[model samples]
Target: MTVQPTEPTTPRLEWFKSSYSTGNGGECVEVAAAPTHVHIRDSKWPSGPMLTLGPGAWASFVGLIAD
Candidate 1:
C-alpha cells in the first residue's frame, strides 16, 4: 500500500481588516474567505503566516465569540 499526502493549493485572497480596527496602535486582524476556507492574519503583518479554517469551523468559532 502506498500513502500520499494531499496539500491544498494557495488561493489568491482578498483580505480585509476588521471594521472594529482603528488607526491607533492596537492588536488587530485581517480575514479573507475562499469557497471552502477562511484565512486570518495579523493586521500589522499582511505578509505573515495565516491561519486557515473551514467554513463550518469558522462559523462555530464566530458563534462562540459573538456577544
Candidate 2:
C-alpha cells in the first residue's frame, strides 16, 4: 500500500531549509513542524507533495540519521 503525502489546507506552512544548503541550487529539503507531525518537501519544489511524519516517527528517523 502506498501512503500518499498529506497536503495542508488553509494556513500556509512555514518551511525552513537546512543551513547547509548552498546558494548553488544543490539538493536540499525543507521542513515544517506542526503540533503532531512534521512536513517535509523538496526545497526546489515548494508546491510539490510533502511527506508527513508523526512526532515519534520523525524523532526516530532523525536519531537514526544522526548516528
Candidate 3:
C-alpha cells in the first residue's frame, strides 16, 4: 500500500523577513514561529521550500553561528 504523509495540521504560521533585507532586489531569509518548531524559508522565493527545526535546535544553530 502506498503511504501518504499527513499534512501539517498546525495553524497558519506568521512569517517574518529579516530587517537587513535590501530594499533593492537581493537574497534574504524568512522565518516563522510554531508552537514547538521554527520554520525557515528563503525571502527570494516566498512560496519556496521551508526548513523546520525544533526550538532547541534553532537556538543551538543560532548560538553556534553567533560565536
Best by TM-score, which number? Answer: 2
Q: Which candidate is the best by lDDT?
A: 1
Q: List RMSD in Å for every model shown.
A: 6.8, 8.9, 5.5
lDDT of each: 0.89, 0.88, 0.88
lDDT by residue for model 3 (1-67), tens: 9999997886888888877787587747889988889999998888889999999999999899889
Off-target runs (Cα >4 Å) in candidate 2 are: 1-9
TM-score, every prediction: 0.77, 0.78, 0.75
Model 1 alpha-carbon drift over 4 Å, by segment: 1-11
Model 3 collision count: 0
Candidate 2 lDDT for residue 2: 100
Better of 1 and 2 by TM-score: 2
lDDT, model 2? 0.88
Cα deviation at 24, candidate 2, in Å, is 1.3
For residues 1-67, what per-residue lDDT tens digits would candidate 2 score against the true structure? 9999987775677999977788799857889998778999999988889999999999998899889
Q: Model 1: which residue pairs collide? A: none
For residue 39, model 1's alpha carbon misses the true position, in angstroms, by 0.1
